[model samples]
Target: MLALFAVSLLWAFSFGLIKGELTGIPPALVAFIRLGFCFILFMPLALMAKKYRPNLRLVLLGSIQFGVMYLAYIASYQYLPGYLVAVFTIFTPLYVMLFDALLTKRFNAVLLLPVLLSILATAIIVFKMPDSGQVLTGFAILQLANLAFAFGQVAYKHYSVTLDSPHKVNMASMYLGAMLLTALAALPQTIGSDIVISQRQWAVLVYLGLIASGLGFFLWNLGARQVSAPLLAIMNNAYVPLAVLLALTLFNENADITRLAVGGGLIIISLYWAQQITQRLENKVD
Candidate 1:
């Protein structure tokens, strides 16, 4: 579990890598290139887990995740700083929370109160960043990315439960879905002037494809098999806060922590409280 948490951190902190790597490439090309590597990596794993019938539905869900969600994330970061994008990642749990309520057919408005607070805190935090007035554009791009990611998440939360054994599942197929869909979506940009990427960009492309998308998805899926949803959500969402500090320390970017830190802290507190309440209710039902 701790290792899984570290994996999430690795995924989170790699914003520096993306920022470094994307400098030489276009967003679609970066996404397609990365997914291409991920497809290759997932091939062996999918073969090894051949006996377990692939869940086509989940694969489609993963496709939406990559094609729509991840594509938007990469493109947004091209305009926005990586930190802003990371900050939006924190809101993933909000999608999970809403999905849980809708799927369970329960109205836990109290629990969602925290979720709302968290969103508000995150907004204030981003607003407070010291970006020499360059953040407005970044902020807009990031908001679009967030909307894209949310759409993907909504699809996942709705469809993921259809898989009979998500706990100990064939994660390879899920990634394969993403890999194929992202490739298809990315095909349009592969032609024309945007197709040619330099060597430095290629290095970055390989890293994003192999490490971030390929290995990262592999690790995350395997980790999910060993952990619970809430645990995974929390681990993944930790990136939100760590990202601010990562930006400041890593890229020497100036981000005002005063508002975001305090607001985000409160939001985390509310999120945890909501988690506890929801968990207790679930325990009672179970």
Candidate 2:
């Protein structure tokens, strides 16, 4: 849970960071920097750690999971506002939960109701993402990109847990993904403003690439192996309050929202209720 919190913040800030860094560098180029740094750092580390290298099938799987999927998400922010991108990203857990239930043959439609509500509340809270002027076209392109990213996430949920070790798979996936992103970035830019960064911005980039992404994956995959998919799925909802609350203080310091408080209370209560129900169901079936 602590891991999830830290990782979520890291992820939450990434949208803004990426947007800020997109001043003079190409979006693809900035993406390549992020992934490439991870890959460069991990390649030798993976070799040293039990000489880990992925097999062909695992490589292909990781390509979709880490490579194309990530590019799709990052590229979308180019077209849409960062907040809108994050809202769409909240759907990731819902999609993965549905697929995980089907794959594991453990459907829990009753308990998933709370999660559905969480998604609804989150969507409402983060509505009307800033357009920077362009409205429909930008939002539509981002949604399309998010859809592709969601499919990739489903692909990841199927394979992420099967890996023998998260560290092994984590590094291996990044190595291959970095290579792919670097190649893709070589093409001429077709859209989005170029991303440029100052020295301070570079620090954020390192934290994002290393701590947020690299260590985040390591911890998430580790926890995912130990917990139920549904249990872990709920953590996805936590990101909303976490991001909103943090940004509220950091940006405007407007910590006076009666309705938001009520919604938050409802979400927390429902989450606990759903967990208890899920546990009861599991025990009954067991």
Candidate 3:
């Protein structure tokens, strides 16, 4: 959970960078560059894991989680407002629990409360009915992204638990998979476009790729390995309010301070409630 919260802080600044600095850049290229940087930064360190032997299944899983998921997330913006995108993401916690249960063959009805609280809290913060004709299309696109992300989280958590390999090794190989797919997807768009990135944009990409994608994801997945799926799901929503607060502070964006405060408080409360209930259930089992 702490790992996820750390990534939330790292990612909060990213919203402003993408909106302010890299607004006109092609989404695919942006995705590609981010993964490319991650791959470059970690591939060398991955060599230390050469003795562990790379798993093909894990690599493919990483491709889906990081590569395809990013593609869908970046594409959804074409049809949805930023708020709608954020609102749509509230469903991700539910998806995480559902997918985690399905994959692991264990069901916990109690997980629903945390998921519900997360959605409600996030909805309070970001919900606004879209007036656009393509609202449904955008919602669908965002859900696809959400499911992909949820699936990845569950899959990686399950996979990592079974492995004796180091986290850095797995991250290095996983990022390689992401880089390959993103590069392939972005190549056509980047080849001909005269998308000349200014120095400022380049700097933004470097920060996003190095700090955000590289370190942020490493810490998040590391945290995922330690927490329950419900906790992971709740923490997933942490970025919403954090991003909103950061936007207000750094970008001078107008937001409901009261709503932000209340919503964030609810999320924190939801986390605590989840931990308590989960501990009680574990004790019962023991």
Candidate 4:
């Protein structure tokens, strides 16, 4: 849970940063750079940990989770504003719950409460009716990204329980998979384009790659492994309100303070409710 909260804070500024800093860059190239940096950062740890052989399952998981997710996520920014990108991600918690249920082959009705509350809370903060075809297109693309991300979270949580290796080793392998996919995706785009990244943009990419993508994702998955599915689902949306607040403050984006206050309060309540439910469930199992 600490890990999740830390990453949420770290990621709070990413939506705005990506939209603001990397506006003219190719989305695939941006993803490639970010994942590339992450792979470079983690591969050394994977190498030094001799006992940790790259797992094929983790590789595929990375391809879908980080690679595909980044591809769609960054692309959506082309069509939607940064805040709307955050808003559309409200569906991710629902996807997380759905994917977890599908994977586990059982549904916990009790767990649904927190997921619904989280969704409601986020909707209050960021939801808006799409007024353009492009907005709807962005929403659809963002949902695909959400599905990939949610499935990855649930899959990693279940799979990590069986592993004895450290999170760094596992993360390195996943980043390798992500790099391969994103590199391929970027190849065609890089062939003829005059990809000129300003110094400021380069700074943003470096921070995003190293801090946000590399460290943030590592902590998030690490935290996911420690918590229950319901808690994980709720935590998925924990960044929405924060992202909105950051956008308003840092990017000068307009937002209703009343909605941010009321919605953020509900999100906190939902998180607390999920935590209590998870503890009780664990106690019963024990």
Q: What's the residue-level lDDT of 52 in candidate 3?
A: 59
Candidate number with the higher TM-score (1 or 4): 4
lDDT for position 53 in model 1 = 69
Question: Which regions of candidate 2 fall more than 4 Å away from where they truly are?
Answer: 129-166, 190-197, 253-256
> lDDT of model 1 at residue 33?
66
- Candidate 1 matches the true fold with a TM-score of 0.75
Worst 10 residues of 3 by lDDT: 48-57
lDDT of 4 at 219: 92
TM-score of each: 0.75, 0.79, 0.96, 0.95
The order of the candidates by TM-score, greatest first, is 3, 4, 2, 1
Error of 3 at 215 (Å): 0.7
In terms of TM-score, the best-performing candidate is 3
lDDT of 1 at 17: 66
Error of 1 at 239 (Å): 0.9
All models, RMSD in angstroms: 4.2, 3.8, 1.3, 1.5
Alpha carbon lDDT of each predicted model: 0.61, 0.60, 0.86, 0.88
Q: Give lDDT tens digits, candidate 3, residues 194-244.
A: 988999989989999989999988898899999988899998898999999
Question: What is the clash tally of candidate 3?
Answer: 0
Worst 10 residues of 1 by lDDT: 227-236
The segments of candidate 3 whose C-alpha lies over 4 angstroms from its true place after superposition are 50-52
